[model samples]
Target: MDDQTRLELEAAAFRRLQKHLMEDRTDVQNIDMMNLAGFCRNCLGRWYQEAAAERGIEMSKDEGREAFYGMPYADWKANYQTDSTPEQQSAFKESFAKNVENQTP
Candidate 1:
């Protein structure tokens, strides 16, 4: 594939992942995702912000989150976030260090 095609394919895959996490599987908690997979919606948003920074887009954390979630982060939390269980929280705590090490807040 050409460079343009590869980019388009990657972008499409990203959009699909975003839709899966944000729209289709809203029940999946971010903490649980981080514990299990070492990343979550926040990480995705962070990556988005970093990518924008790479190209001089100057996106904020909140702005990147809003773009990914299709609403304000506060609103998304209010509507969809559930309290994490102790087990999940503990796992997340362990996972957090490694995950955050290579990413922005």
Candidate 2:
């Protein structure tokens, strides 16, 4: 219930989410996730990078993406990324703006 324990629990849950995305959600592209959930693997990586910096550990965006994706992000994109439809792209743009506004801290 302390701050340290809460952080550990949150980190563990994040790891499980990453594992699920990598292992069970191969069909779900980042674009679709962004359009629907307003966040995706790349966002998760950025968050991971921020968290590492908060602890004074310098982790690159690429390193964070690799940890989340279970492979190099470029490799994952080459192998898994599908072309987004125009509708999906439009929805993503709208959702992205709202998502950003909601996350202002």
| Model 2 RMSD in angstroms | 2.2
For residues 1-105, write the lDDT of model 2, one tens digit per residue.
899999999889987898788878888988888888889988888777888888999999899888778789999999888989999889988887887546843
Displacement of residue 14 (Cα, Å) in model 2 is 1.7
Model number with the top TM-score: 1
- Best candidate, lDDT-wise? 1
lDDT of 1: 0.90
lDDT of 1 by residue, 1-105 (tens): 999999999999999999999889999989988988998998888788888999999999999898888899999999999988888878888899878875554
For candidate 1, list the clashing residue pairs, or say none.
Answer: none
C-alpha lDDT (0 to 100) for residue 73 of candidate 2 = 95
- Alpha-carbon deviation at 98 in model 2, angstroms: 2.2
All candidates: TM-score? 0.93, 0.82
Error of 1 at 9 (Å): 0.7
